[model samples]
Target: MGRIAVIGAGMGSLATAARLAVQGHRVAVFERAETYGGAVGAFRRDGFAFDTGPALLHLPAVYRDLFVKTGKRPLEECVELVQVDPASRHLFPDGTDLALPNASRAGVISALDAAFGAGVGERWGDFLGRARVVWERTRRPLLEDTLREDTAPLGRDPYPALKRGLLRRAPATVAAVGERELRHPGLTALLSECVLSYGLDPRQAPPSAAVLPYMEQTFGSWYVRGGLRALADAVYERCEERGVEFRFGAEVTGVVEEDGRATGVELADGTRQEADVVVRGAPGEPLPGDLGRFVVLLALRGARPADAAHRTVVHGTDAPHDGSPDGPAPTVRVLRPDDDRLVPDAGHEAAVLSVTVPPQGAVDWRAPGYADAFADRVVAVAGAAIPGLAERLLWREVRTPADTERETGAPGGAVPAPALAGADGAWLRTANRGVPRGLYLVGGSAHPGGGLAHAGMSGAMVADLVAGGPGGSR
Candidate 1:
């Protein structure tokens, strides 16, 4: 059995450790932080808890496969998985409210039609139909298989350009598709918001971005009982069960290499842990930051409404892209879980408010009074859905990219954008294999890019690479 060293006890690293352990490889995980779940972390204060990273999970089958392949117990046995029905409630700038049902195409169609017009549903359904082609064409090469050095095939947009009567071609960018197909301003914003949520610019993102909404609306959005961190905890426990050892507060300074082949990791303490393979779960260099979120945790005075949707998205206005806080009202996501575990008691509610903004390097996210101003703008935007939200705020907690950087160790507190298929496939992430003979990359910054599900895919690719060689069995 080969000895494997995994850097960062993140979801991807943990998945790699667990899978390798099950395959008879000895795995040890090293985490710089005291806890696991790199970007997927939880924060608690004053008896209330909030998920500081991703608040929901889409395409859960990735984790489900990891659990089933590694142990007798399934994912459901590890965490209480609840499908967030009405996956999201969207409030458009025009006062349009749409509660899109989870995983039910028909239900979503009806919801859009009811909220907008009869044919609006048909148009969106048609767009989804087109997006399905993109997902099918790109899913295997971009997600399932190991990313190749010449990923130009995956980079070229697979979204089919529809022939509209006299026109021979369809739209190019995601924003163009919204304008041409969706027609209505509110509907266009709905589609754009999907890409924006991923830290992608809808204006520049390819039409393949349709896959973002398609994947979520098709597979469904879910939440663990306590929080996403609970799922991480379960994965960590599963790794422990499989004899994968972990050392918290173990900061890896650099890769210990022999003739360009990674042999192990050099820790901050000057001690070295040797292994046959090294899986890097942490992010690489920062690109001029994409979309970073400003989070506000609100402890409300009353319980969350029984019929409340788990997520709500407020679309922003098309303001100029000047480098200022008041440039444009950023898109906002508000999550309120029905589970009482997040709050202090049954009488109160804990809600998380997140607004997508430019990365810290692009903006002075930590300037004096910047936090309060951004928080007020976010609260103002979200107030459309939650009446008297400003008053209902018993207390609030704000977290920005600086907080993210402090937690994940990624430079500039930059959050990695999910890999996209466009810009000459510029969005394609680094390959899993061929870094060196023994070095490999895992987690959101690697192949298939970041996001809960995409990171799991990266782990699967890396595990396969090490277990079966570069051309390993997947």
Candidate 2:
């Protein structure tokens, strides 16, 4: 057994620490903040709670594998998965409303076909099949390996695996992939939605990411009962039970290296913790990856329109008055598909509303009067869905790109990492690794791009590398 220290207690760090500890290695984690979860963290105010990051959860299989590695089952006991219905409703300018399901391939296809005209379903299916192939081919090479040995050493290329007929040809961007599969512009819009969910533009994202929408629509979007944070907390709890120690409020400043090998981490306070292995879960340098900014406003009381479909619903005063006939009234609407807005302001209840903006650079995001102007624009866009959504004036909040970077160390506050669009950018992302012999890199920034499942698998792959050497187990 070896002593190991994991930097940052996000999902990736937790996964690594858990696996190492279960392997009988002594593991300790240092978190800059008082809590874990990094971007997946949560906060509360006035008896209401909100998830600060990763509001939508998908690919429970990744969490399942982590639990299994720790000698436990994830679903039956740890966290109960709540399947989302009508995953989200897409509101189009042409007055067409499409409801997407979490795991109903037919439902998604049918909805698109019904709204967009004939033959769209089959095309969508074919596009999804291509995505599935890519998933199979890349899952192991990218998700299950570090993709690099250490910093300054870029490791092996995973392209040969895809070239072996296991995956499809990857386009430079999601738009390119969708354009190749379907001729309809709406179909392209549907595919671009996947890019938005990952905080990227289809024109700038990797074609490999085209599989994400299929994953969400086929596997079903899910949420933990207490919110997504429960997943992080559960992982942390399991780690503790298995003898992992966590040091909160320890902001890591630098990686301690010897002979070009990572040996430990130096905290912001100058405390150096040594270990047989080290994992970096936070970004050290800023990059033009995925960026996200959100404003969350909560209502202290009263139920509102929720469920998977809420993500795309166009909020409006005329929103379907689907209030509960038997309990507290509830109504929610999606005002603008591109930006977040509420539909109606009329109601004698409390509610929480969230508005998300596209990913952009720090300086561009902070240009004078951007926040106020953006908020006003959202209100205007939502005016159609909710007649008085802007007037509801209960509470309001905003998160700038800089704030997101400060909070999560996410390069330029990007979420789900940037797609491996260009060969150069892809190589740059894949180049860094552990500086010391025993250390490694395993997170969204490492390989297979970002996503909960991919990052978790990255950690497991690193453990496998240590156990079986760089060649990996046969």
Which one is best on TM-score? 1
State the lDDT of candidate 2 residue by residue for 62-158, as single tens digits: 7887888786555549876676666777665667767776688887778888888878988888778777765676554444445543423222222
Q: Please list the residue runs of candidate 1 whose C-alpha ends up more than 4 Å from where it truly belongs after superposition.
A: 163-170, 287-289, 318-325, 469-474
lDDT of 1 at 45: 84
lDDT of each: 0.82, 0.61
Residue lDDT tens for model 1, 1-474: 999999998888998889889989999999999989888999898889999889899888999999999999999999999999889999887778889988999998899889998888888999899999988988887788887767768767888756465766756788888887778887788887778778777777788888998898888889999999999999999999999999999999999889889999999999999999998987787444256767888888877778877899877853212235657777778888988899899888888888766666677767888878778888888887676787778988888877788888877666777777866776777777745689888887887887998888888889988877552224
Every model's Cα RMSD, please? 2.0, 8.1
Indicate the worst ten consecutive residues by lDDT in candidate 2: 316-325
Candidate 1 positional error at 113, Å: 1.5
TM-score of each: 0.95, 0.81
lDDT of 1 at 99: 93
